[model samples]
Target: MKEISPKEVEHMLSDGADMNIIDVREAEEVAEGKIPGAVNIPLGLIEFRKQDLDRSKEYVLVCRSGGRSGRAAEYLEGQGYQVVNMTGGMLAWEGNTE
Candidate 1:
């Protein structure tokens, strides 16, 4: 799996890049805040929800910290999905959140 920094992700979003952002954090964590327009699919439920993701699209995985998203990215990559782990996750994200 590849890795992308928060700054790069933020810039890409602002530039209107065609990409999918998936937050691997749990509901409670996401309720506090999350990158704007990101879709939440907690790490624990990734396997069950894998079918919801499109293999043809590019995706960025995020979490409270980088750990969980890194694992998620690896799993998706193994399944032949184009995915990248957002480095530093929300802790390093400097972009707007909802």
Candidate 2:
């Protein structure tokens, strides 16, 4: 699966890139903070909520750590969606969050 660093993602966001950012952490975990404009789609619900995603858009997947988002990226890639796994996830994100 393709991967991107947290700093890269932050730069893209700052540049106003039109990419989808999906946070795969649970809702409770998301309450703490998340990348600005990131959509919450916890890992466990990916299957059911996938239809909400646009297959044409490239997505950046994130989690508390890199593991879960990596899995999500793999799964989405298998399903024919373009995806990038954020290497260090939220723990490594020093960007602005909402």
Candidate 3:
């Protein structure tokens, strides 16, 4: 699966790039904070919530660490959705959050 560093994602946001960022961490985890504009879709619910995602749009997946998002990316890719896993996930994110 495709991967991108948190710094790269931060730069993209700073540049005002239109991006589809999905946070696959659980609700409780997300309550802590998340990248601005990132939609929360816990890893466990990805299969059910996937219909909400547009296959034509490329998405960047995130989790507490890279593992869950990587798995999400694999699943989404298998289903033909364009996806990129955010390497190191939130742990490495030094960008603004909401």
Give the top-scoring candidate (lDDT).
3
lDDT per residue for candidate 1 within 57-95, as digits (tens), equals 999999988999999999989988999999998999888
lDDT of 3 by residue, 1-98 (tens): 99999999999999999999999999999999999999999999999999999999999999999999999999999999999999999999999889
Clashes of each: 0, 0, 0
lDDT-based ranking: 3, 2, 1
Worst 10 residues of 1 by lDDT: 11-20
> Candidate 2: which stretches are off by over 4 Å?
none
Work out the TM-score per prediction: 0.96, 0.97, 0.99
Q: Which lDDT tens digits does candidate 2 get at residues 1-98?
A: 99999999999888999769999999999999999889999999998999999988999999998999999999989999999999988999999888
Worst 10 residues of 2 by lDDT: 12-21
Which regions of candidate 1 fall more than 4 Å away from where they truly are? none
- Ranking, TM-score, top scorer first: 3, 2, 1
